[model samples]
Target chain A: MEEIKKHVLDCSNLNCPMPIVRIAKTIRTIEVNEQIEVTATDPAFKADVEAWIRKTGHLLISYAEEGRSRIAIIEKTK
Target chain B: MEDQKLKEYIDALVEEKVNEKTLAFQNQLENIQQQLSTVQVRENEKITMLVTSFELDKVIPAFIIANGAASFGMDVTLFFTLWGINALKEKSIYKGKNIKEKMITMMLPSNPKSTTISRLNMMGVGTSMMKMMMKENNIETLPDLIDLSIDMGAKLIACQMTMGMMGITTDEIRKDVDFGGVALYIEEASESNITLTF
Candidate 1:
């Protein structure tokens, strides 16, 4: 198996549409083979981020709840 | 002596570099002009204009758009109707003379707020707070905004259907408003590139 390089992203203070927008932008700037781990605190982050991930045809490896914050690991397919 | 001569030579080279940059900028300007000449913009450019029937947060954008479009030389019309009609009501609402208006303002905290905040715990509290804040800030309430819209030729039209549904009559509506049906609105909006429902 090939080793996957990953980057961590923290978007705790962002509101609706902003977290998704920032993540999409970050994904575009990364190399095709790398993955990004996103962390956010907004209550709507899970559904919002997941919806965006599905819409953009990206992969959501896993999502977890950390206290008030929610975290998701996503991979760039392109 | 030789060092002094070298410094003079460097100064001359810097002056020549500056001249070269100026020429390059001039050349870039000419290139831009050439590109502009070849670039064709459509004769009939579509412009988007918003039509708002809601109050305050919604109406503010309409006013801003109308002012912006008029300033930009675009044909802009904002049609105020229904509750928006109250905005055009006599400025006396803000003057505290109308007991009915005062009662409605006092009772607004109990009514359902805008659709966006109805599900929240604060319910109409946010809207109530907004109204109070506007009064304190000397911001025009919904009625005053309607008056402003009228003064700007924003085309305040009371919806015949809405008024009929609400059992409101022409006598009840403010004097500045022109009553119209959906067909008239559609006719006016036909030439518009932008139409928004608030």
Candidate 2:
């Protein structure tokens, strides 16, 4: 299997727009098809990430939760 | 009988031509409508907010929305006028030349940190309690939110007329803020898809 390049973004304890905003900004810096694994503790992070991905037309590889932290792996398609 | 048949044939031809023309016109209209809807979507990507109040509750929501929109890749403009201008002021000890200006400076909060809530302030106790709660919840402070909004590319425009009336000098305001008047606000608000007053 080919190894995929991925980046990590830690948004622990951040709420609302912070996680989404940082994701949007970070997506621009990486090359297309690269993945970003974002971990945030905000309760709304999962829903916000889904909405953001829908609006921005990105691909959500996977989303999971660990304790209080919500994690999402998003691929930058554009 | 031949003449009658000829007349009927001509009428049928005319009706068919008219129907074809009408269908073409309708298609053209649909294309134009699609183009117009696309333009509307593009224009709606911008948001303009008019902040006229300096109360902590009001200020927090304004910045939150502004920052949120900015983070969402929307163009956000925050126009500060009257008491709202105080949110952009630097927290410093400066004296005004005239007594009225001095009094105004003394009465108004210097910056977002010192601003009081609209109701249940109880001599700053409520504001303090709210700030403590926000801190405990990992929520960003008002000052931090303002800075983040600016950092996120939200345009901050201070009302020049209000500054003149309140005797707020340019030096007292943050250097990153742009100064404007009512005309500027009108221009931004007209182009924005969302216009809110706080």
Top of the candidates by TM-score:
2
Put down candidate 2 lDDT per residue, A1-78, tens digits, no spaces. Answer: 777889999999887767887897798799999999999999989888888878778999999998998899999897
Docking class of 1: incorrect
Model 1 preserves the real interface contacts to a fraction of 0.00
DockQ of 2: 0.57
Per-residue accuracy of model 2 over B2-110 as CA lDDT, tens digit each = 9999999999999999999999999999999999998787743889999999998898999988987886678999999999999999964456458888888899998
lDDT of 1 by residue, B77-129 (tens): 55555555444343222242256555544333211123122233276677677
Error of 2 at A22 (Å): 1.8
Error of 1 at A26 (Å): 46
Q: Which residue pairs collide in model 2, if any?
A: none
| Candidate 1: regions farther than 4 A off | A1-78, B1-55, B80-125, B135-139
- Candidate 1: residue pairs that collide: B87-B143
